[model samples]
Target: MKRRHFAEGAVVAALAQAVAVPAHAQTRPGGAGWVTSWAASVHGPYPVGNPSAQPEQRFLFPSPPDGARDQTLRLVLRPSVWGRRARLRFSNAFGTAPLVLDGVHAGLQLGSATLVAGTNRPVSFAGTGSVTIPPGGQAWSDPVELPFAAEPASPLLAGRKLAVSFHVAGTSGPMTWHAKALQTSYGTAPGAGARGAEEGEDAFPFSTASWFFLDALDMEAPAGTPVVLCLGDSITDGTASTMNGDDRWPDVLARRLNAAVPNRVAVVNAGIGGNQVVGPAEYGPGKPFPGGPSALARLERDVISLSGVTTVVWLEGTNDFSRNGNASLEAVRDGMVEGVKRIRAGVPGVRVVGATVTSALGSSSAAHGHQGQDENRKALNTFIRDGGLFDAVVDFDRATLDPGSGGLRPEMIPESTTGGPGDKLHPNRAGYLAMGSSIDPAAVLPVRR
Candidate 1:
């Protein structure tokens, strides 16, 4: 495989430029703050990474390089916590040319591609309706007040999805996207022109299971609200769980926190399917991997740069031991050590919890189910529990491991999304619930005063 290596310093510098938020935009009146209510970490440019349950996109975007031309996209995402004011982040992290976007709007979703009546609000950047983000860069929109989210702590808004619509002006070159969103989002046909302000679903004739351009959404929240970020690979990304079910372990964790702490906490997932902890030494548009960037490479952009992050749950490393990766066990362990150190340095007083990788011993996937791979996974899990590197540990392995067969529990092996036997690599909805319920909320959340 051909590999292109860019200087790590250069990549970090570029990401730093992309995440630079203006000083005035940091806080709201009376010391209210911004917390990342939702986030989808961007990997490679379009059509280069793994996307689950995706529909054919040749009709929506004929040329991947030319990207979306004069089309509107309505992305559906659920916020862990609701707020009266919110901001959106658009990224061009993997594009080869400037990404020009306009006609942006955010509203409460009534259903597929449609927003609640009188709730669609226009979003602006620096007081303007449109913004141009340079290649390898991103921009955050000015705070847009959400009239529908009057009470941030209201149970009525819990589990409701947010509809963020935006138009891609001209050609987007190579679009930055998160493949494997697992949630269906709507889009207009190419050259259909800007229809983001439309409240109806007629303008969006196509659907995709991925998110493009737009990445992070921040809600104005209380100053001390704790934000728990789950950083890992597909399991954390909800693969094989359910279609539009929001049953990922992080989603379960969020619900747990909401019931225990009310609106005092937020949980965001930053997982990418096929991702590894450190094996892919380099990643960019020229040398893209199906897994996206390595955990170490993306830690800065995905974990450190997000707003109001108080704790991190790191669940990864199974991919690094897979047949495709074949990365040594030491490399994976050290990479995680380095990653945790970076996270602590970037966010002061942040607690980092390590979750053991689950069993893939008898997986149906060709790349997994090897004895050697399972051995490596066990070694890593042992380290996670006894290494004393993390503030806490979540025993996901014990939660789903079947001692009899050395594989996932029998009840957790069947697929829940489209039905059929599962790959045994990624857990099903029941397995995810087992993993989620195993977590002790107090271990990952901030102690009450």
Candidate 2:
């Protein structure tokens, strides 16, 4: 009827190891679990242009599936929730207005691809289901009582399957998603995600650079090191990569961390599509995109507010160099300065890595094209590398800039973007791979004792 998570099999492999250990302060060598891994999960508001078949797009979404449509998409996942606390992430990263939630629920499922009966038990934000996410903001549901939670004594989720589904009702259509999901996400009931409803939920875990908002999904870890959050815009968000390929820069970083290092690090991406450094979306006349959010305004909420975050890789601002997105190098510089300062103030002593806004050679963003925009890009990079506003500088431009045209290489641009939505801007899977490899591996992993 109801189960929290998978308790045996591959997921439970560790249960044996977990048993041999002492209860308190033994401090022995560790293997891999949530604490041993880089992050529990990764996904965000950055929407891919489209993934569903044409029919699905029209028949279901008609337009695009925005947050308001409580289109419940089901995925029969066999992943592990092997920790004490869990998180359910929701996004409004692209909403021009706040994203609202109503009648959200996640529980063990009894069916497979199709549904026979859903618990229909409500999910909540800090215990309440109705959550109103701010424009371009994301929210994570408080971990409800998962019939199947992680067990440290063994491979937490040794062998199991989980079916998680939720409801949303604020913004309708035009939803942002990375890849196609398992279940068909039917549109929300007639009037879900609406603005005014007597039921309202309190705050949950959120971050500007967080891939998706996080909530303490009632779950447990090996009871050691905290999590590390890597916050930024699209590049950090890992768009364009093959679905579930784990190719985003954050994903890449996590793999590297888990493969060898110690310390227990988690890289969470909180990037949004069409995110700007200082303003809302940039649909330069005649171009696509509807709106965007200013990176400066969101840094504190997204980057510093995450749970157990020890570091943040601030990599964003490409959208700011619009026809007029940012006034000048001065504007970009001020934003950077303020954003960094605000984060430092909020987190005190947390290491901030300044990732140079990567170069956008053939960018299709309407804001690009003008020599003025290029000027702003170069100008902002100057500050990122020269201003010394961060503990260390991660140069994304240095890693991916093409030797030929001085923009992203052909390998980097996605087929769809090149298919023409806007060539020159985003990268495809290969490109995301290069972007992922570009980062210095040492900077992110845990320190060896």
Candidate 3:
């Protein structure tokens, strides 16, 4: 496939060449401190919350079985950037009462429910191995040094995975989770007690594709490593991407950046399938949908609060024009404008780039394929492209749409997961690759540290 990062814009060409420069010479944002390498935007407690077009059985956990009481959860995540010292963030953002957790551990993931021997490390909060997170609150574990010899600049650690294990002390009233991980993470049966210290799979027999409790991960990196946050809906969340495949647009962009410049930047996804830019005015433990909160309500937590975020790419708004959303085009545009304003106000120097929504004119899904919705999507895209509200624009519509039909390109219509004709609303792996490759890396990495 053609590469987007190899293009020859003067600014980008200069920045691309600078990727190999010494880390000390670059302008690191956090002053050689910790920055988020991976993150999942938490929606609400599992079982009772929204999952946005995902199959129902995937989330049928802590139920039909013993329940989530006293169980250990070992989540596996791929860090975009590596560090010698690592810390994790756990959320009780939608919980009803105090959520007590203990027996936190981190290590390199070897395989299913297994960690590399002698590499496991304990994670603590406030000098204790356990802590109680109050309702609607979140906690960050104290830094735990990774035992691996790979430093931040080590090529050996590139594409490596981390297994983070923790036990819920008692009955978690409601669990906070990111429903569609697209990656399998291990979990233990209810009443399994604290087994985060165990390296074998004996403690964790149950399997899930979703991540619970824990949210974001941060690691120390060289100063100035650009952290790019991709914010949007299902397309950005890799809806039709391969199961267990990190083929999301952001993932593709990350690999492209890594190939050109090993560790100059890290890309994290903040998209939620079925997410809308506006509407669903009230969201929380109450009134939860498969689509979490509106983009406006979540911008502060999902985009602004992330560490070392230098750029944001937003590709959303289809959900707003859907039958369920019913939001006017004007409302959606206003929301996008407000979101950009808020990001600029909150982050100061961060750049927000608008991404045109891809075509869904012929989608077979219940919520899409209407001409009215198509018109609204086109209107929104026009605003995203012509409206001077953003620092720059990525014309995804032009990249993915068929000019003749005003629908998704035929090659982009097959689902990567089930291997059938896709709904046309969400793009397949090939489509994502095209979309990811379409992004001008120069526009994203303007600084090119």
Which numbered prediction scores highest in lDDT against the true structure? Answer: 1
lDDT score of residue 140 within candidate 1: 97
TM-score of decoy 2: 0.64
lDDT of 3: 0.81
Can you give the lDDT of residue 280 in candidate 1?
Answer: 86
lDDT per residue (tens digit) for residues 1-449 in model 1: 11122343432332233222223224567868899999999987889888888999999889998998989999999999999999999999999998889999999999989889999999999999999999999999999999999987888898899999999898998889999898999999988888989999999989999999889999998766678899999999988889999999999878766764456578999999999999688899999998999989998899889998878999999999999899999999999999999999888777799999999998889999999999999999999999999999989988888888999988888988778999999899988888887877656765432
Backbone N/Cα/C clashes per model: 0, 61, 6
Reference-based lDDT, each prediction: 0.87, 0.48, 0.81
TM-score of 3: 0.92
Comparison by lDDT, 1 against 2, better one:
1
For candidate 1, which ten residues in a row score worst on lDDT? Answer: 15-24
| Candidate maximizing TM-score | 1
Tens digits of per-residue lDDT, candidate 2, 44-85, equal 233433232212233333344343354433333322223434
Model 2 has an lDDT value of 0.48
